[model samples]
Target: MNRALLLHGRQYKPFKGFMEKTKQVWLVVFLFAFSGRVAAQADTMARQSAFRVFLDNDFINLRGHGSDQAYTNGIRLDYFNVLSGRRGLFSWMPRAGENSVNTTGVSAMQVMYSPEDLKKRQPDSSDFPYSGGLTASYSLHSSNPAKKFSLRSEITGGVMGPPALGEEMQRMVHRIMGFIEPKGWDYQLKTDLLINVDFTAEKMLHEFGRGAELVGGANASLGSMNNAASVYAIFRAGHINPYFNGFLAQTNAYRGSKKLFYNIIVSPRAELQIYNALVDGGLFRRWSGRDVSKANRPTLTASELNLGIDYGFALSW
Candidate 1:
């Protein structure tokens, strides 16, 4: 009996050692990945294109998913006199053409500009267009807690052209508060909330352009960090353009008036650290594409895929 007990104890010692080493290895790997992501973010912020130009291209083929094969390209340009510090930001989110399967088109570019950099360059508050810009953002995380949690949010907004122009739009919009146009860009006040805890992880809530729309969804991240991905289900409801159709003199006779659609998106996002720069690639499938005029039209099964990439730059005082 004594000899048998000794053999069992000896065998258990190796198992315990193996478990401890395994835990240490995983911890090291997690720290390495986290540090790498932070370093990449910093690098992105440090390196600014002399002209500050950005282009995002999406070559999406949506056949088995829901729609036809489609491709999208977006371009953004910023001209800055790094010497004199004069800068201008311009962008376009135009689509190649109308897709028959999904009838999807890219939204207009969100435009914004500031004479001085809010992050670093502080100008006289009295200066025209001193601060602000257009808004665009994204976030990502996991549903499982045993892994790690990564969440991010980005927003860009500011007045374009001279302060006088912003004043002009304000004046005109108020003056013709009763007149309506077919369609036009509307100011947006979007807020996003994300929560990941317990088994019920990942929730997204968003409000777009005031009462124009309300959206909510849940997501699940699958796979490991090296091969991470997520799937989400989203629901959007509200007027297509409340300001344009109701206040901006736009005709409300078509299906474009008040519409609601249920969209399911199988989003695949990947992160990579290259040369200390963190690059994120996203692909989205927006299903149930249809223009609702009377609310009785059958919802289309077509899908629209969007591909996007964003790079964050780290700045330090």
Candidate 2:
């Protein structure tokens, strides 16, 4: 009877421990959700002009990830508002200030890991492990704040450090692949250089007496994915309630000028996304880049197609 009692006691202890841990997890989640109340209350009083700081901070948190290619993540933050102070610009059509589409109010980036080390020990978990990068861009445009339609243009550049310990991994992979190939062996290193340019055009529209808006734009890039472009549309479902809005953007990709010459081809990428004041996430499919050499041309393809999620608060005034 004592031995049986001891076993039962041990089982009960584990069950008790699990329940305690579960309670703590719930508490953390509850706190995270409730923490936004403070920000919401402050925003209610500010009327949307003084919330730039919070918006900037949130943007960095959402889009920025560690910089390691094998483990580092990438982040991007963008904002476009045409209703603030420029009411007269909407009266004019087809033409707006040249700087309108060229401005980016907040821009910054950080590198988080080194590629050489990543290959030495491949982590099992899906977290940013080893990578580094730099991001720089210029923001232009904003002659009128109340314009119904606004335009924006931006140029960005950055370099992504190789995956954590990728060189060693590449060497191993090359060795393995070479052993299978006949006589001569060649190794191609995977590295990234980032270059991007984008334009945005936004307009306000009404649907059945409801206040709504439309956002659409195109983006082009070279270093990271060869050539990529995107267009998006967002609608405001709330009236008099500016805090709740919904937006969707569609992105496409294609081979570019450089690829034409190198025979390094890639099929276009396609993506769909939805975002609101509280949440943002998306689904995407891509075609990988090919390697074209003097002797042979290689074709690569996308290896992933899936959805991703992000949880955060956004404040813009």
Candidate 3:
């Protein structure tokens, strides 16, 4: 009976130790899970509180050297926020990676086009047509830092021609800058409805330390305003941020380390333009007693294939 009791005590001691170790393992797991959840919540809150504004104008183009022709002035205003709930138009979109960030944004934009000589009341027919567009767009952007990829989708609606107020905006700016008044307004593209959908995808090709990186991307647009597809590569150097964070790295709200940002970028692109309403005029015919082509205005014969290079520098805090 003594031997049996001793054996039972030994067995009980081993079982008790095993049980205690199992409990400790579960406790560690629970702590880790709790900490992960807290971190995720913090990230979500930071994204929700972030906002940004953007303005673009060809008048500020560094390569133009004060000349305004072809694709001229443009202005854009954007507001963005992280999507808190997956119950919207963009909810069905697939994320790029396991831990991808999603953002929704709205924007208002105005674009202007003109010939080389703005002083001529009746510009050369072969020159770029006088046209303008004003649009409002809703967009969805998704990015994955680990995979170094991003996706963007957007839908836009608005109007073209005089209703866009391009001529008036240009005149106001020119008057403010003490430049010569533009001469051709009546010959601008006629009023027309504008609607388009666009999608873009970008991936980091390679990274050369923290100072430089190469990114490649493609964009597609379809609608009454424009139908085109293009591919481009971007080379950025200087104090650059992660490009996967967002367009122009504007959506890096969770980054708390950087107080200032600056970069020099060079992008080369090739586009196959199926159609461009701004250059080709409206798709539908107008019988308003105006002498015009099938598109209801004077249009230029634009190249179906276009190649261009862009250089710019950005500084922001």
Best-performing candidate as measured by TM-score = 3
lDDT of 3 at 185: 78
- Supply the global lDDT for candidate 2: 0.28
Deviation in Å, model 3, residue 222 alpha carbon: 1.2
The sequence of per-residue lDDT tens digits that candidate 2 reaches over residues 142-248 is 33234445555556665544432333443343365332211111111223555655555555443335433333333433334233333434443222222112110
lDDT (0-100) at residue 157 of candidate 3?
Answer: 94
Question: Residue by residue across 216-262, what tens digits does model 1's lDDT show?
Answer: 22222221101222233333223222211111111111133223322
Q: How well does each candidate superpose onto the true structure, as a TM-score? A: 0.17, 0.37, 0.70
**Candidate 3 segments exceeding 4 Å error:** 1-66, 209-211, 245-263, 286-301, 312-317
The segments of candidate 2 whose C-alpha lies over 4 angstroms from its true place after superposition are 1-95, 98-106, 111-130, 141-147, 162-193, 205-210, 222-226, 239-317
Clashing pairs in 3: none
| Local distance difference test, each candidate | 0.20, 0.28, 0.64
Kindly report which residue stretches of model 1 are placed more than 4 angstroms away from their true locations once superposed. Answer: 1-145, 161-265, 268-317
TM-score of 3: 0.70
Q: Best candidate, lDDT-wise?
A: 3
**Ranked candidates (TM-score, high to low):** 3, 2, 1
| Reference-based TM-score, model 2 | 0.37
